[model samples]
Target: MLNQIEAFQPLNGASRERYVEDLIFRFEANDTTSTEKKRAILMILCGPYAYVMIRSLLTYRPLNEVTFKEIASKIKEHLNPAT
Candidate 1:
């Protein structure tokens, strides 16, 4: 998962929105269970944000603490506001 993130271009603004959408679609198409999808979405985040999330994950644990789905939804809200 980390390798996949490394291979993709880092994004901001509109591109980030598209990237997140694509990731969600991919996860859905893969028939990944909800839990796996959430974790994968969180792992896909790059840069300083990713570091912060990782630190939190380590401290709180991925499954029992904050979920990847919640994080992804927050990101979508911030990055893809309605016109």
Candidate 2:
């Protein structure tokens, strides 16, 4: 299934919105509704930096207890910080 879908590229030089949109498209294409599955896919495909950032962002919360939306929101807030 990963081979069929376009590979997730590194965040370098890419817009965060584009990166997130691509992830959502893949999730929809696979009919993924489970939060756990979404979080797994996101962490696995989002590269090491993002994985670490997510962990740091949710330091107080157990990773298993974190929601996909929370991870996504943190990524957005980090990548698109206001001036």
Candidate 3:
């Protein structure tokens, strides 16, 4: 699947909101299965710099300590202050 794409870079804050929407649209359009969806979502959440930031938030605890669900929840809360 990846070979067909020209390039896929990790997203940052500048247009991350739009990036997320686009990712969702692509995933849904492809009819991704639950497991594949979870894998793709994890890749987004665990970008190259994410572990360091998540660790700082957790005071340097082992990354295994935080489940992906917890990470996603924290991210959602951070992104949607009004919620």
Candidate 4:
């Protein structure tokens, strides 16, 4: 997963790190509406290189103690209910 994420990258380390931090913080807060969470997740998943760094960090370490796969699966399920 990390390798798959890294393949899309050319991101600067600091910015990438910040994005990871922000993602973790948001996930932890759990204050956003389901719609908002789905939107953000969709934005990340839909983009090409834009979300690569964040995805790499997620695959590398669990955010807010939640597995990236779990969050991603949920988001995907939300987007595609029939799946």
On TM-score, the leading prediction is 2
Residue 26, model 3: Cα distance from true site in angstroms: 1.2
TM-score of 2: 0.79
- What is the per-residue lDDT of model 3 for residues 11-72, given as tens digits with 9 covering 90 to 100? 55544444344544555666755654544565554555554545566675554556555655
Clashing pairs in 3: none
Prediction 2 global C-alpha lDDT? 0.75
User: Could you tell me which residue pairs clash in candidate 1?
Assistant: none
Q: Write the per-residue lDDT of candidate 1 for residues 3-80, one digit (tens) a residue.
A: 354322335545565655666666667676677545755464555665464455456555446566666665566555
Error of 3 at 20 (Å): 2.2
- The reply for model 3, stretches above 4 Å from the true place, is 1-14, 44-46, 51-73
* Ranking of all candidate structures by their TM-score, best first: 2, 1, 3, 4
Candidate 2, superposed: residue stretches over 4 Å from native: 1-11
Clashing pairs in 2: none
Give Cα distance to truth, residue 20, candidate 1, Å. 1.8
Scored by lDDT, model 4 comes in at: 0.46
> Which of the predicted structures, 1 or 4, would earn the higher TM-score when compared with the native?
1
What TM-score does each of the candidates earn? 0.52, 0.79, 0.43, 0.32
- Clashes in each model (backbone N, CA, C under 3 Å)? 0, 0, 0, 0
Say which candidate scores most in lDDT.
2
lDDT of 1: 0.56
> What is the lDDT of every predicted structure here?
0.56, 0.75, 0.50, 0.46
Give the lDDT of residue 24 in candidate 3: 49
